[model samples]
Target: MTDSKLAIIILAAGQGTRMKSATPKLLHTLAGIPIVSHVLATARELDAAYTVAVVRHERDALVEVIVDELPNGLVVDQDETPGTGRAVEQAVASLPADFDGDVLVINGDTPMLDVQTLAGLINEHRHGGASATLLSAFLNDPSGYGRIVRTPDEPEQESAADTAARASTPLFGRRVTDRNGRVDRIVEHRDATDSELAIAEINAGVYLFGVSELRDLLPQLTMHNAQGEKYLTDMVELLRRAGSEVTVLPVAESWLVAGINDRAQLSEAAAKMNALIIRGWQLAGVTVQDPATTWIDLKATFEPDVTILPGTQIKGATTVARGAIVGPDTTLVDCEIGERAVVKRSDATLSVIGADATVGPFSYLRPNTILGAHGKIGAFVETKNAQIGDGSKVPHLSYVGDAHIGVDSNIGAGSIFANYNGVTKSETEIGSNVRLGSHNVFVAPVRIGDGAYSGAGTVVRKDVPAGSLAMNVAPQRNLEGWVATHRAGSAADVAAQAALAPQNAVEASAEQPAERTGE
Candidate 1:
């Protein structure tokens, strides 16, 4: 629910040409979420009266995500005018015309802008009682950003250089009274002179302004810069001229407001976010064995004493209980890992592993799979929509799909719950203490009763009664010399002939021995 105190306007209409992708720049994923979501998350935390997204490029796609992420959000489309000022003007118009609260404007591309920093800016502005608060940062190289020029510290003792600067731009000449070190104006990098370009302080593109102050000054913006666009930075000059105190907040870390304009920046932000998340988890008593190789989405939760091993990705609201150890290469998506469960080298999605359960050395658990306490979905096994009861083990090299196995049952290696026939898929049910043997295929719609045993190489198509055994038993037959005949001149044939030579010699000796004894 929105309340009347703050209105956050996220400017997302810019077409990011440097990103060079078919997908809209704001839709690009950063730390497992869209870039705009990072800024939107901050807005939600602020409990703003109006959360407005100003969009022009990829409007439909951007709106879909916006509506999904924030159901009550207001969306405004910027008109044909190509400027940040115009984008924000359209957004502010969408809100209540009489909203006399703070208007927090932020760029859509800066994913590193967190809720705490923004809240701090808002708090500082509110307490300081400024008409507008500007976020600024001093960079070692402020090459491509607008430089922030402040009014003279001593208004009465203006030097010759200062007078020339104030006289050169109409923005500086708008002052009617004495100004004492307020943010005078922002000079665009393309428009700045040599000395102005040397200024290390750059405008951070974030602003907190009184709605009335912002509304009043927005119309005064002019398209006189290199791009012939009414830059939002122009508001600093306009606000100062209107006798409004523009508070400049020099952020401690400039990266907090850094914009992601290319693939390199995207990856850089992701790495920094991952490191921050992992460090936070570690501080909360979760052991991350390899922070460099591990990643976790924002919605994932963990209990204390959980050990996250190397190459683990906990994605999408996954929860790991205390004493659980995940990975050494594992990916879990929207799954729940119970207490003391050990999941190694596995991939599971939307599944539940109960307490003390063990999964994988290469297991693939599909959605709806639930392993009960002390159960094992072991090496090379794949399970889908299967419910494994407590203490049951599907130990190796098996595919168990659309099946339910009761407690203490063991599914043998190379076994498959053949749940699908051509037309539709069915299910297999194995009862308690059942021993399903090696190479068995449980044809769908079949059930094995309690205490039953399935013989090796069995194909179970019918139900087995309690305590009964099921097998497709057949008599063993030997095709004598089959390998020698069929595999002629091969290794088997050579070995067969070598064995026959000894027997042939023994038979000859027996046949000749009688004649030799008689002689």
Candidate 2:
């Protein structure tokens, strides 16, 4: 809300060693986009004057990828693997020499952060006229977080009575002002006394600082913590000691304070992000039934009043025009569905469905396929690289490929365009008002002219001219006496073999008798 120019510093310099991944952790996709992309998009939404992302990973390819995705920003490399404070310092060097506005620091991994919340933090920082403002939250168990220790608004008069009153007051209490909200001091857990550790307020790692103040105290940050890394948190103590104005404002939501250090935490953050997108769409007149089961791509755009049923996967630059109904089991990639089109239980890629077209119950539309207005693609149908004319119907059990069908044509069941050979693919052209019967195969490089009709069971290998009836069948001939001749020949052969067996035995006996009498 302030006219003061704002610059965003995204701390992406860490390698995310705890992710245990070979690829850079920020490069991993969340909802079909890299995690850092979401953060960058949010920053752009806030209309920040400039956004610089700090990188310190081993792979330069990661930085190149980020540069390609975010063309407007400069990618500053932190040559040394120091700490977050040093990462910011590297980014500060890249800032313009005339920079004189407020600086906002956000972690790149916190993609689920909301824009309005960040805007509020920036407004407060500018309004309070303080050196720095921290986004803080209270946790039930704030074990690992840095605690907030409030110096009494008016220092206790160093008397026994005042000390007793301080002990009786709340541990992490802050005085609230009407204009700028609550105020407190930040103390790290390791550096805090036992009394301070009892406080529940924790730092959420989001910071807003006066540009001049950051430039002044940045050199004082040191590697004094247990991790032996220069901490940005140390600057809070340094700023307060220097009598510079500092304050901690409680975050409106606790989830905004969470950080992802491992896979389990990452999953939690992703679930929260999923809910946010789904709820936002549902409120915008897009029906997302059973939000838990629906997966909408982060970049997929839907016009107002679009309905998305459960079990839908819309990804990869797909867009649905106004008043369209999709899914309940549909997958679409790089496809466009025109106004009021219906797509159910189908897989579509790189296709376009015209206004009021109806597809599926079970359909597969491959790349380059287009369905005209009021066209119908029914159950068990597949199409590839084909454009169906307006009001045409390919109803039930058909495969139409590499072809163009004229308007008002009716493609029958079990009809297929055999568009491919062992060597090459071909196309089939069907004219207007053509009627194809069941089980007809139109072998390709073929054409059916206007008002033509094909008989059932027809296998067409050639083109049919307009207004013709094409019937295909092989001629039949009857074998009249074939059964009788085969039966007589079988009887005679059986009788002859039976008589020859006895006569052969008698001849052998007579020959033996003559030989014995002569002897």
Candidate 3:
């Protein structure tokens, strides 16, 4: 790179009507982050001396998000002109008057442009000593793009044969390179003639301008064209007219400069970004099964040997440690998964799973929940604001909330920490080695001491002492013959009558036979 100090101006003012969204187009996400944010991150990688983001549509919301990411960076509001040229004008006005350096102007919606490409553009601009340099690409279908127009290096010849040959050749608007093969000018498709429209090289809308030259030319922009808007493309003609060298650097990867104008374009950018991220992780030793179905956020990190199964979305600063296996269907946000832990078919947020812990085949771990080492929170369990100590287990069909379980404790299936009353929420604390039976409910503000046993159906409202047993059920009792007495003329009554008639007939037969023999 040259010794010139760098400044970046990001144009984010357009309302993007084609997006058909209430949200600003720049705020639309690509790979779990706003498109503008991705651009900002790339700009940061350039180490620019100053950065400015111009916002007009949804200005307040856009500014808030931008400030959160770039607190010290400048933000300028584009005025009523509503054009790329006007947006850059506002950004330039906000900069220090004495600052004269290279300014990189980029569309905020073009998140696919990487740092290497941007740095390459800047280096090329600086070394070429050109007044301006714009990135260009050759597209098979350049229907909506501005075409690059250049003059051929061939000398004019007066010979009749040479003239006929030149005239017969289709040289109207084709890529005519100079002796050194450099770009001359760009013609918008609307203004290009039939032959000019056939040109394949199109402008990529990314440019680096000398700050002094750009500042001088911005005011001279006129809205005399079809759109009635001041176009930045006009600056190329203005610079060249002033006898300044304007050049174009062709980018091989056209997607690098592709803009997100609608839902379809946004999806395309996302898919491309997803592929890049997945490929990076695979090279780093993380196993991502079915990269097409797995969506990992830019801020997420995965340790080596971690396996992410299909249908998983790991978002928002989540980190998976080595040997951890997560998901065939799982979503984790801002959580930490320990080494060797397994989280399958679960959704977790703001939680922590300790080493060797096992969670879910279907579980929901909410904010502040922490499962300790070797602990297990099995299928159909949901926990929030709870902490399970090392070796503790809350397996299957349970809800543990606002509670703390000691080491080696077993929370039986169907048990619950009923920490909420009609008005307030409280906590339940169980000591080490406590045995809580199935269907037990530890009602708020209670504690069970070490070695305490809670029988099935226990609803503990009061605390239990050490080594104690707690049960909350009535003693056993029998209600024999109650069905026959109460259910008369019903199935029970008829069955009882039929059972007694057999015994009565047997006794009657024995007595009658003996009397007849004596007579």
Q: Each model's TM-score?
A: 0.90, 0.78, 0.87
For model 3, the stretches where C-alpha displacement exceeds 4 angstroms are 1-4, 152-181, 189-197, 476-519
> What Cα-based lDDT does every candidate model obtain?
0.87, 0.79, 0.85
Q: For this target, which candidate reaches the highest TM-score against the unseen true structure?
A: 1
Candidate 1, 1-519: lDDT as tens digits: 554889999999989889999999999987678999888887788888889999999999999988887789999999988899988888888889778889999999988887777877788788877888877766677889888886666244232244333431211122212232367888999999998887776788999888887778788888988999979888888887878788777666667888888898898999999899999999999999999999999889999999999999999889999999999899999999999999999999999999999999999999999999999999999999999999999999999999999999999999989999989999999999999889999999998999999899999999999899888979999988898778999988888889899998988888874444553
Q: Give the number of the best model, judged by lDDT.
A: 1
Which pairs clash (backbone N, Cα, C closer than 3 Å) in model 3? Answer: none
Model 2 spans > 4 angstroms off: 1-4, 20-23, 58-65, 141-199, 303-305, 422-424, 469-472, 475-519
In model 2, residue pairs whose N, Cα or C atoms come closer than 3 Å (at least 3 residues apart or on different chains), thus clashing, are none
How does candidate 1 fare on TM-score?
0.90
lDDT per residue as tens, model 3, 1-519: 423388899988889899999988988887778999999988877778888999888999899888987877899988888578888988988889988898999998889988888877787778878899888766667788887776554332122232223221111211322322255566777777887787776888898999999899999998877777778888888887888887776665678889999999998988888889989999999999999899988889999999999999999899999999999999999999999999999999999999999999999999999999999999999999999999999999999999998999999889988988889999999999988899998888999999899899889999999899999879989986676788978987888778877986998887784445554
What's the lDDT for residue 5 in model 2?
A: 84
The model with the greater lDDT, 1 or 3, is 1
Q: Considering only N, C-alpha and C atoms within 3 Å, which residue pairs clash in candidate 1?
A: none
Measured on C-alpha atoms, candidate 3 has an lDDT of: 0.85
Q: State the lDDT of candidate 2 residue by residue for 1-519, as single tens digits.
A: 423388888888887888898877887777777777778887777766778888878548666766776778778888664888888877877888788988889988887777877877787677777888877766667777787666676332122233223221121223222324323456577777887777666778889887777888888888877777767777787887888777676664567758776677777877787788788888877888788877777878888889988888888789999999998899998899999999999999999999999999899999999999999999999999999999999999999999999998999899999999989999999999999888889899999999999998898899999998777977779864454467555765567556666986887787784444553
- Cα deviation at 357, candidate 1, in Å, is 0.6
- Is 1 or 2 the stronger prediction by lDDT? 1
